[model samples]
Target: MAADLVRRLAAEALGTAMLVATVVGSGIMADRLTDDVALALLGNTVPTGAILFVLITILGPVSGAHFNPAVTLVSALQRALPWRAAGLYVVAQVLGGIAGTIVAHLMFDVPALALGAQPRTGMTQWLSESVATFGLLLTILIAARSRPQAVPALVGSYIVAAYWFTASTSFANPAVTLARALTPTFSGIRPDDVPLFIVAQLSGALLAAGFCRWFLAPEQAT
Candidate 1:
């Protein structure tokens, strides 16, 4: 059991670290190559999607590859995971996100931009986060419960799509959002804005949990 727990936690941390690194690293590198944020964002999207697909497959057996609190929370609510394990997963994810951001800050040169940080506080930004998070949770539930084998590719595609569709660039992970705040480099959120974004994300996650309970009721009962 102890060994299993260690493996789970390690998977969670590694998955989350890869997630943040994929977004921040790719974005920063792209920005250095091209001045266009749009081009850079597009460039990041490909690798982000590819990485998520591979990571989910690689880590799913150990930790379910839930690199976000929202994903873990919703999964727990859906009975896909126990609350205890979900709690540990969330902690691991958050810590991984922070560590990944710190590494990105150290590795990349400082830019005029706020390190590809997430937006906070504005009504539009909050709304974007809410929508993005809802979509993320919804995707997880749908993918995991219905098409379990397809989860890796489906989730990766969904996240990449959400990035372009959502105003807040679909940063649906609170841990990742917080980690971004710590970096002043490519993808950091402002420290002042971190709390509000996290609040919005948590709220969105809770709402997704409730909705998933109702929508996936048949599956949950099984």
Candidate 2:
């Protein structure tokens, strides 16, 4: 069982690294390919979604495909994930994300471990994160309960839409958010702005988990 857990954690870390690479790498590629911000974002969006679908589909069996600390926390809160396991999951995710950012920088020939300078603070950005994370958790929980098989595609598609809809580009994952802060690129966020974003994300995640608990809990037998 311990060996199994290690393997599962390895899957989480590797899957998360790939996910971040997909997001940051595509954003860099998009920015280089287009002068138009809209076009650049469009370039970034599709690949991120596509890779997420692939990652989740492939890694779901091993780690429940949770690449986000917010998701892990929610799962633990609902007793779906054990507390110790959740801790390991979150640590693996953060470390994996940082490594992924470095890989992205290396691939682009950008300075490795450069801090993002983009100012992403303010109420609008914070609110957007909350909304984005809330929707993400809601999607995961509801989809897992109703149509488990379609989760990967649904999550991927929802992220694509969230990228367009949210002001902060739908950075709904804390691990992803922290990793983005390491790159001074199109997808990067200011390091200073990270705490606010994470706070809002956690709040949103917790609230969404509450709603899911009530909504998905089996009712008393007649």
Candidate 3:
């Protein structure tokens, strides 16, 4: 049991690091394609989603693949994971994200960007973030509850879509956004904008967690 727990923690750290690496690495590529934001984004989206899908499947059994703090909190609130595990997982994810961002910055020879903060509170931007984050959380809960077989594709596709559709570019993962700030690449967020975006994401996640109670129902959740 102890060995399994250790493995799970390590998996969480490694998986999160990979996720951040994808974001930062892609950002570096996108920066080279700067004049064309759309193309740059497209370039980044494919690998980001693809890697996320594979990582989730690879690490899901071991760490439950809660690469985002919001995901971990939501899962724990639903009793899908223990509270202690949730906190530890969040810490690992955050650290991994930071490490990944740093490595990507050095590897790509780009100055680190500000923390990847969520976009600000313009009506459209805020709505975009709220919707994006809500969609991500909703997708996870639904996949976990009903379509277990389809989770890999569903989660990946949802994130890919969110990146294009949302103004904040679907920074659904707070840890990821924070890490991205450390690198001035395609995926980095500005430190100044981090707090607001985080607030929005956390709020969105809380709403989603509440929605889960209704959507999944008491017996269904367990």
Off by over 4 Å in 2: 218-222
User: What shift in Å separates residue 142 of candidate 3 from its native position after superposition?
Assistant: 0.9
TM-score for all models, in order of appearance: 0.89, 0.97, 0.91
After superposition, the stretches of candidate 1 with alpha carbons farther than 4 Å from their true spots are 109-119, 218-222
Backbone clashes, candidate 3 = 10
Q: By lDDT, is 1 or 3 better?
A: 3
How accurate locally is residue 181 in candidate 3, as Cα lDDT from 0 to 100?
67
Between 1 and 3, whose TM-score is larger? 3
Candidate 1 residues 83-133, lDDT tens each?
998889889998898777656656775432244444455988888888888
The number of the candidate with the highest lDDT is 2
Q: Write the per-residue lDDT of candidate 2 for residues 182-218, one digit (tens) a residue.
A: 9999999999999999999999999898887777777
CA lDDT of every candidate: 0.80, 0.93, 0.81
Sorted on TM-score, best first, the list reads 2, 3, 1
Candidate 3 lDDT trough over 10 residues, lowest sum = 112-121
Give each model's clash number. Answer: 9, 0, 10
